[model samples]
Target: MLKLVVCVKAVPDPEKADRIKIDPVTKNLIRQDIPMVLNPIDKFALEAALVLKEEKGAHITVISMGPPDAASIVKECMALGADKGILLSDRAFGGADAFATAFTLASGIKKLEEFDVVFCGMASSDGATEWVGPQIANFLDTPVVTMVKAIEENEDLTWTVRADFDNGYRRVKVQLPCVFTVTRDLNTPRTLSFSGIIKARKKQVDILGLEQLGVDPEKVGAKGSPTIVSDMEITSNTRETTMIQGTLEEKADAVLELLKDFGSIG
Candidate 1:
């Protein structure tokens, strides 16, 4: 049977307006009181894995790296039809930038040693760096095709993938055992079905700490991160605003005047 590994991340739902809250000291994401949800783009990655599973009888495994609470995410993946799910959690793994996260994920993937294909989201909602998947592929010495919108396996086990580029799609063919970061256009991710949700409780999610996976402390966290987020600040709409209560034509004229003042239009 074909074996596939899909990497997913839990992110604070950012769909809410002005919902981002950062930690004062660390300048990092404040998770203490936030409701975390799976990264939006990861739904596409999971759906792609599920499609491949249905078409080829593949064994899909979902893996993530985060805190112990991440166990809940693994069960959610199981509910989505993944055969296995794992959480790579440990204190030493905290504060991991995308590089460190990729390194640790590479270690965990190395341990699995069985996936015929690997999938990842285009990027995390919080970080948006879009670096981990290709970096992990570099570490694993596997070819990576990213921003994939559609994928199919050929008779020779080569994956034909289409990626959105400048104004069109780019077609790529990669041999099996490669990696890809899927785009949101892949498929619509179904929520938990009754039977799947019931079966999820019975499905066992394998949780592994850093030590359990032999992840080197010097190569898997802050110590291994090469780049630091020196600073981040919330965007402020501090510009002055004037209320213009008027009809559609008046509003359009007012908007045109404002644009002229800003040198956007003359």
Candidate 2:
């Protein structure tokens, strides 16, 4: 069976985006009261893994790094057809930037001992740096393909895939034990089923912290993060409305003239 590992992230629900706040002291997002859900793009990663499981004999292990409550998202992955789940949770791992987060995730994958394939979303909804997958591959010294849109071939130890680029895509052939950051174009994710949720009850979710990962204390969290946020503020969206009082032809001409002035029309 193919040993597949999928990395997932828990993000604040997009619908409740208005409730998101920033911590003035830490300069980090304050999500204490907001409901958390799976990062939107990660669902595509999970769906890709699930497709492989159906076509090939595969055992899926989903891993995530977040707070204690983050385990709920991992559990949801289990219910979504992953064989097992792993959570990397610790107060020390808080306020991690992209580099630190990738380092921590790579450490967790290294502890897994064996894996044939690893998948991650192109970016996280909250961070959206699109660096974690490639960085994890760098840490593991493995080949990586980012923005994968489709898996064209998956036979034996090698696979061929299509990856998105500027305006088009290119076919890439990579061997197993490689990392892929998938895009939403890959597949449609399946919704959670009650039966699947019941099956997840038996699957175990292993929690690992800094101690379990065995990485240097100063190199795994905010301390290890070199990037700093200088400032953060909520943007206020306001619209300027103008009333046009005229006959139909005059109003139409005015709209066309405005569009031309704004460069909205050629």
Candidate 3:
């Protein structure tokens, strides 16, 4: 049977972050009391995996990298039909950007390298950068296709996919053991059935620390990270203030005059 590994993330609820207070010296988000939930996009990723499993007799596994609380999200994935869960947790794994996180995840996935496909959401809600899937693909030397909306055919080692891209959609074929980042429109996430919920409670999750993975601390987390947030500020400049309200003729005339004076319609 083919193994499908779905990568999921536990993200902070945007509203939970509304109560954050930054430290003057550290400038890190005060996440002590902030509540988090499983990221919505990853739900689509898991759903796609489940649909494939139900149709093709595949074994599905879910993995995540975060603190201990992240295990909760993995359990949720199990409740949705994932056969196994793995949590990549360690203090050394903290403060990872998309690249570092992907590297660590790729390393962890390598430990269980029997999977035939890797699945993930296009991006995390917290950091909408959407760089991890490609980064992991680079680390694993596997082909990657992002923002996929449909999976037409998946062979033991090949995939024909339709990705929603700029201007329109694009069709691409990729080899297997590859990474895929999905958009929400890919499928409607099925509700957790009662049987799935019970099975989830009985599923075994393999938790691996940095040491168990046999990797150096300096090579896994913040120390291994290549990117960091230097500055984050909200700017207020883009707005539409010149509202013109009138009939069609008057509005057209006004627009023409304004464009001519502004050197646009001369």
Candidate 4:
């Protein structure tokens, strides 16, 4: 059976984006007041793994790193079809940048003993740095394809995929034991079912702290992170409208000039 690992994250529900806040001191999101759901794109990654499992019997493991509350999303992934769930939670892991987070996740994956494929979202809805997946691949010393929109399994050792680029997409043939950061274009994620939830009741979400993963505490959390946020500000969205009075052709020319003045277009 193929062994697959999908990384998931709990993010503030986008529906409540207006209510989200940032901690001025910690330079991290203030999530306590906001509802948390699986990172939007991460569901696509899980769905991709589930589709593979349905076609060929496979063991699917979902891993997440966040506060204790993140276990909720881990359970949700199990209810969606994962065989096992692992949560890496510790106070020390707070405020981690992409590099530290990937290093910690890579360490946890190493503890899994064996894995043929690893999946991650192209980026988190909140962070949107799009660096974690590639960084994880670097730490694991494995091949990685980002923005993967389509995948086809070949022999046990090889797989084919289409990854998005600037102008078009690239068809790639990669070996097993590779990492893929999938995009939402990959697949439609299924909704959670009651029966799946019941099955999850019998399944457990194992929580692993820094020590449990046998990682250097200094290297796996905020302390190990090299980047620091100096400041952050909420952007104002107030808009001003102007009326133009002229002939149709004149108005069109005026709009083009305005766009050029604002650098909105060349």
- Model-by-model lDDT, in order? 0.86, 0.92, 0.86, 0.92
Which residue pairs collide in model 1, if any?
none
lDDT string for model 1 (1-266, tens) is 88889999988777752666777776677776667788888988998889878876788889999988878877898998999998999889888999999999988888885778889999998888999999989988899998998875445678788987878999999987889998888889888899999999999878888779886788877788888877876688898878877999999999899889989986
Give the per-residue lDDT of model 3 (tens digit) for 51-83: 989888889889999889889889989998888
- The sequence of per-residue lDDT tens digits that candidate 2 reaches over residues 21-98 is 877877888898899999999999999999999998789999999999999999999999999899999989998999
TM-scores of the candidates in the order shown? 0.88, 0.91, 0.88, 0.91
Ten-residue stretch with the least lDDT total in model 4: 151-160
What TM-score would candidate 3 get against the native?
0.88
CA lDDT of 142 in candidate 4?
95
| lDDT measured at residue 180 in model 4 versus the true structure, 0 to 100 | 96
> Candidate 3 — worst ten consecutive residues by lDDT sum?
21-30
**What TM-score does candidate 1 get on C-alpha atoms?**
0.88
lDDT of 1: 0.86
Better of 1 and 2 by lDDT: 2
